[model samples]
Target: EKRAFLAQSPQLYKQICALAFEKVFMIVPVFRAEKFDQPTHLNELRQMDIEQAFASDEEVMNALEECLAYILKEVREKCEEELEVLGQRIEIPRLPLRRIPYSKAIEMLREKGEEIEYGEDFSKSQERLLWKIVKEEAFFITQWPEELKAFYAMPYEDNPKLVKAFDLIYRGLEISSGTQRIHDPELLIKRIKEKGLDPKNFEFYIDCFRYGSVEHAGWSIGLERLTMAITGRKNIREVCLFPRDRKRIFP
Candidate 1:
């Protein structure tokens, strides 16, 4: 029998910690076996992950917005000379950033004459076009289609077809993504089955909720992606000292 190899994401572990700690944050390495090579993608990277118990998606998004704005402000104030050399300007985005629903985003794209479907994920070009249309340096796309998100994402109370999830887009690139996770064990199991996944494999995670659990939402920011956005770098690799992608792995 072939042994399964674990890849790093910190999704499950972070949630587990949130159950006990109420709020937690970590900067950790992540690994993915992505097949495609893109300027913004890497097989291995660092992520800043945060999870908070008794929090809704809206609250989590607000926290992320404030955190990102503070980071940019600090960079702007402390690294003026470095930014000047790079010809980069860090603009602190306004609070409570504009949120465009997934459905509305699809409509906007269609209006712009882009060939796109409602349920499909956005391509890189589509993301850039959306930035152009919105004319915002940073904003959020929220309430994604349920099928497009992970099984752990909480379904919207009003619409089962959608999830309480959001993505932070900066400079036409996704810097972070998050969701209000499903806390009910029954619902989690149901979602797992719906996704054609074996719940047995997730017994450890589900068992944690069986005892007691609170509502929680979390998000992760890709360190390299965030750096690229702040520095106005065209490629994520420009910010990462040792980038690992499909084509290159060695330092």
Candidate 2:
């Protein structure tokens, strides 16, 4: 935890594996210093990260989505007793969930009488509004403003203003955000600088790219969020086995 700030996903893992393995999937506990004690918010949670080297971000998404589809189905079949006890039913979505873009989501929101500017990221109330209408749409939203996403997401070729990033929204909330990662050392440094983060602090990561790396893409899902999606809980805390929040530190 000291050396590696709990990465929201395996962004570094994918980059490291790109040097050797063509494909890598790492599932681990990621720690996020979230501010709230919301139902889905946890300081420590499980994350499933899958990355593919030598593949376009689209292909990576396809692989990731396929893997999730299979796993969700398998869990429903194998964990019938558990689901029954929890009063939950997992609906396995089909391959190729619909992809939407920020521009369209804005338009849809505007049509519903919301006031929002083009440059801003979605606020919590804004996301709630989205869920009110989206209602069970298992889809991804891509081509986000570069400023809105993390530094690692690949910027678009045709339009540098937008990144090749995508966020998966299940039911209504954002479950995961993924993209083609920045592999070029110089470009990554530039992005880090632009994001107002210190490159020196991330030197250990910088060192890895100097040896060998490739274009890679992957994603991380919030375990609590996934559980809430499975259990139909609006607040994130409801799905956790033991709750930890900003207000409560001890069990």
Candidate 3:
């Protein structure tokens, strides 16, 4: 398959399954061919993806926040010796993590002397700055501009230009990203075109919605980035046994 590419995420497939199953989750390795040389960037990585029908972004985010807290508590209590080996200490976040709007985040960043333009994704430095302002190990940034989000992200009701999406930022790193998906076939097509993507190529996915589909939302967690945060590691490669970044391909 000369044209075949590795799976970047289980998002699309999980969304499809959620139509029939109501809720679905998957944990698997994913690949990205992007050229990134950052400490946390990787060409191949693992992720935890979850999808649910009839759920709003807020509902899904609450679930994910609780999940993270539970995992962190367990690791703190159960992996004492292991953490000692790595000289890492994890702080379990409190329930109902703090949430900030993207607009507010931009304002905060600008106040802090960080030059950020609207509708553009935050840079790594900007993420760190916002994390400091929130004063929490984990926080959510919601109401992202629609143009900055994926094609499936549902635009906001009050302002159609912004999407009902949120990013889970942990310890200055983006640990998860998700949104309420556009369920209507017509709306999905419009979003596809808005994102400058071809609906014809996404026909298989689009056709599924034409029959019947429920409002759905989901998020995917970057396994390495999560590990890096939990372990207080500076680089994502440290968490993986065999890392694959912009340069490395083989052991």
Candidate 4:
């Protein structure tokens, strides 16, 4: 039998579309092989993705904030009764959500006695603690270390150690992540090699850029996780109709 795998994410497709179409969005199912059996870990979930050519990380972050705020506003106005039934009240977040640098976040965490290291990804508890400090319903953690982000993320021109990336944390959970991609084919290859991945494997992806690619940025939002944030659900499975995780796949 041949080994097969499901689509883990629409990242490649989105980038390709951005190169050709300038802008594109999709709501699709994504699969993950992670073995995490936690309240927020789902093997199969829905993702809402968007990509735009000639855009920066700040531009995409603004778009994401507006998109989320609009959704919450609509829910608050139209789903009042439904929210009442669920004993929840959705708050429309203010525009231009707070942006915190990764370094600053790490410093704040350390001050709060969190023994977290500088290049480490934030744990759920750390995220919650960050929420307590910022006290904002939604915010962006930006400029993550390049080592922690995907190879495609564009490194800062002044400081190559950090990448132009951001993660939107809503109610202490990372609902979306985005970055300005490296449009230069050479840079793409270099980043791939730096990540210990053979550039040959990403030949097709790199080839797309050789034909004159433009700078682009995009993001993906997990539908179930967003639902969990909006509905105040403790578990992501509660928001998913047929949640798939490490266990319980049957109806």
- How well is each residue in 66-137 modelled by candidate 2, as lDDT tens digits? 866886888899989988988877888876887778998898789899889887877656666776766644
Candidate 4 lDDT over 161-239, as tens digits, reads: 9999999999888999999999999999899999999999778888999999888999999989999989998999889
How should the candidates be ordered by lDDT, best one leading? Answer: 1, 4, 3, 2
Worst window of 10 by summed lDDT in candidate 4? 242-251
Worst 10 residues of 2 by lDDT: 1-10
Cα lDDT tens digits for candidate 1, 1-251: 98886556999989999999999999998899989788889889999999999999999999999999999999999999999999998888988899999999999999999999989999989988999999998999999999999999999888999999999999888999999999999999999999999999999999999999999999999999989878888888899887889989887
Root-mean-square deviation of each candidate, in angstroms?
A: 1.3, 2.7, 1.2, 1.2
Score each candidate by Cα lDDT: 0.93, 0.78, 0.90, 0.92
Q: What lDDT tens digits, residue by residue, belong to model 3 across residues 1-251?
A: 47876888887889899999999988999999887799979999999989999999999999899889988999999999989998987888887898899999999999999877988789988898888988899999999988888999999888999999999999999999999999999998999998888999889899999899999999999988998988888888888998988788889
Candidate 2 local lDDT, residue 219: 75
Candidate 4 RMSD computed on C-alpha atoms after optimal superposition onto the true structure: 1.2
The TM-score between candidate 4 and the true structure equals 0.97
lDDT score at residue 75, model 2, on the 0-100 scale? 81
Stretches of candidate 1 exceeding 4 Å from the true structure = 1-4
Q: Native-vs-model 1 lDDT?
A: 0.93
